[model samples]
Every structure is written in C-alpha cells, then in structure tokens.
Target: MEAEIRFGDFVREVSLRQTHISFNELAAYPKLDNKIVPINRQNEKLKVSLKDIYRILGPYTTVRFVDQVKAVIPLAIYLMFFQIFILRQGIADAALICGGLLSVMVGLMLFMEGLKLGLMPFGETIGNTLPVKSPLVVVLGISFLLGVGVTFAEPAIGALKAAGQIVSVEKAPYLYAMLNEYSGALVLMVGAGVGLAAILGTLRFVYDWSLKPLIYLSLIPVLLLTGYVGIFDPELAKIIGVAWDCGAVTTGPVTVPLVLSLGIGVASVVGRGDSSLSGFG
Candidate 1:
C-alpha cells in the first residue's frame, strides 16, 4: 500500500513536469452498442393461408408471363414475317414452330424469375457465409464443385453440344470429336478451369490483389497455346475458335454472376483499397 501510494504520487509529479495538452479518454466508436433490448421473435412472425398466397402472387405471375410474351413474340413475328414476305417461303411444321415458340417464352420467363428469386439470393447468402463459416480449403473446394456443377447445368453448354452437329466432320474431325466423342471430358476440363479461376479470384479479393498482372500472366500461356495450335497442329487447331468461344459461353448467364457474388462476400471481409470496389468484377 505504501509503494502504491508512492507510485501514484510520483506519476502525478511527472504529469506536473509535462506541458503538452492531451486527453486520455478512448475515441468514440459508432458501431458499439451499449443498450440491450429483448423481444419475442415468434410474436413477430405473420401467419397467412393458401388463399392469401394465391391472391398476393397471382397478378405478379401473370404480369411476368405477359412480359415474356411481349418481348419474345415481337421478334419472332418479325422473323416469320420477313421469311414469308421477303423470301416468299412457306412455314414448315407450323404446329411444331408454335410449340417451340411457346416453350421458349415459358422457359425464358421461368429462367429470369428463377435467377432473380433463387440463384442470386443463394449466391449472395453463400458468398457472405462461406468465408466466415468455412476454412479456405473448404471454400475453394466448394467453388470448384460449384463451377463444375453450373457448367453441366448451363443451358448454353447443352446447346453448344447439340449445335456440334452442324460442324463438318470432314473439315474439322478433331473439333467434331471434341464436341461429340470427347464432350464429357471437354466439359470436365472447362469446369475445372472455371473452378481454378474461382479459387484464384477468391484469393485475389481476400488479399487485395491486382487483376491486371494476373490477366497478363494468364494471357501469355493462352496466346502461346493458341498460336502453337494454329501453326503446328491442324486437326486440333480446327477447334481454336470453338475452344475460345466456349470459354466465353462457359462464363454464361449463371457462372459469372454467381462467382461475383461469392467474391463480393469475401471482399467485404478482408478486402482493402480497391479490392472491395472490384469484388464484383
């Protein structure tokens, strides 16, 4: 107790010797909350019936369906009119054509709605949760799996495969083979590429890395491979356009946005400087 009193007195004597004006209180933090409140979450919940759901959703669904029809039918009609009037071509398989058009409209409406309601929300939620909830390895693994799965599920990839029939086997045997015989492997490789990209991209956001250097590094190998293929390997070279084009299509309607959401989530955590701003890139 004597030593404590002596130390306190000595500290006061030293303060008296100092001339600089200063405050020792901690700076205010806006984020910190001190007041506490309790409430029942169950009481906040609202109950509704099937009739109420139908009433609320019916107009929304109808308007969406009509919007798709308006957007699709006009373009379709213009094409049909051009074919019939200018070319003097008769419509073949009218019933099939109508059915196909109807299917297209419905498919587009469902896809747009599903993307808005399902995939985007899922991606955002997963992106936000993954970094906090899982380790780096696990997050990367999921990105890989997601890339692979989305590639398979991509409407464009399937259409690309079916469109493979138009490629002349005589002119591009390897291209045909890649699209038909080795199609599964092609998709697997593409998925793997996308997955690897996702991993790198995630790391880029987390560590505040630059896209420019990475792009330059990635471009060098790709350009070299493409050039080598164009010069030395004729058969394999046939797929050069398709190969590069497929990369674009693989990024497609689904993959890029989903990847961006995840990256944004990660960036929001550890990202600094321009990383957060470019997270969606």
Candidate 2:
C-alpha cells in the first residue's frame, strides 16, 4: 500500500512493495470488448470477369493439339515395328493384348478389396478373440486350426503344387501321391506351429518377458530338424525345405496383407503394442 499526506504546499509519500500480483486487483480493471465485424455470405462480386475467363482459357485449347502431335512419335514407332517390319497382322492379337491387360487390372482390384474387407479383419478378430477363449487347450487348439486353415488358402501353395508337379511326376513318378500329400501336411503343420508360436509370443509380451531366448530356442529345433532331414530321407528333405519355404511365400497377395495386418492388430492388443513383439516372426 502507498499513502501521501499534504500540508499547505509541502507533501510526503509512503509506499509498500509487493512480491505477487493479486487476481482481485486484476478483476477490478476494466476491459474493452469490441464486437466482431460480420462477413458477407453472398459471393455476388465476381473477381474474374467473363472477358478474362475467355483470355485465360485460350491457351488451353492449343495444348490438346500439342498433345496429339506428341503422341505421333509413339504411334510412328509402333507402325514401324509391328505394322511395317514384323508384319504380324490380325484383330486377334489386339483382342488378346487388351484382354490380358484388363484381366490383370481386374484381378488386382478384387485382390485388394477382398483383403481389406474380409481377410484382414477376419484374421484380426481371430487373433484377438482366441487369446480370451475359455480354456488354455481350446485357445491353443483353435490357434493351431486357424493357422492350418489360413495357410491352406494362401496363394503361395500354388507354387508348391507346381513344384510338386515338376519333381514328383518327372523325377520320381512312383512316390508322387505320397510326396505331394506329405509336403502339404508338413507345410500346414509348420504354419500352424508358427501361428501357435506367435500366440505364445503374445503371451510372453503380456508377461513382460524378453523375446531373444524364445527366438534362439526356435532356431535350435529348425537347425536340428533340417540336419536330420538331410541325413536320413533326402527326398523328404527337399519336400520339407520346399514346404517351409512355401509357408513363407504362400502368405502372398491376399493372404500376406490380411494375415500380417491381423497379426499386428491382435499382437498390438495382447502386448499393448510392446516394441519387442510388434513385428512378424
């Protein structure tokens, strides 16, 4: 607080210092509240007049003519190669070319749409739901079943089928059926096992366990099995190797995108997006 006292023409003043400002003092101060100016909603004023619009659009008409001239180079090149020199004539070739391109485009569209709507969400639901299922055995069993079923439908199996056709029918016709079936079953088993592994990984993440030990332990079995396969059954060895390779490759096109997204989504929920367990194994 400050005070001033005056007697006749002489005066004396006293003042008090403050360390902090008070809200009450601030509240007493008057403030200006200016009203906002309104804006016009109607866009009646045309900045660019009709005359200017015509002038600006004039150059654009010439661009189409220039574009046609630019296209003549490729047209001339095509005429020289296929039409003049090679002399491959007919409407059939044109139809075939157009059809092939259109087919590829359609296939890609369907694949993308299917993955987005069906496979991805489905797999994610399975991953998330399975973790909370009734009993331990049931959850594990369901996970295994899902792994096998999904892997069966994977596009990479087409490669396996083709390879089986090549080796079994050509190299060893006698063991064709057995080899093919065994190859498929073994591959399916591994895929299911992989799925189970991923689930267990989710559990470990929930418990805040490190992943390195599990990864190293997994590698041990893979090495030992591969070694054993190489020694005893050479034909079976090739089949198993191809199956495992196909297990990876088969998660292709539709399956890969859907399954991977699903895996990530489920793992995210289970692990609460733990950094160590986010990626595909």
lDDT winner: 1
Residues 113-183 of candidate 1: C-alpha lDDT, one tens digit per residue: 88866886677678778888899889888878887888888878988888788888898888888899898
Per-candidate count of clashing residue pairs (backbone under 3 Å): 0, 1
TM per model? Answer: 0.69, 0.52
| Error of model 2, residue 60, in angstroms | 27
**lDDT at 151 for candidate 1?**
85
**Residue-level lDDT for 77 in candidate 1:** 91
The lowest-lDDT stretch of 10 consecutive residues in candidate 2 is 9-18
Estimate, for each residue in 176-212, the C-alpha lDDT of model 2 and write its tens digit: 6544757666566657765676566555645655678
lDDT of each: 0.76, 0.58
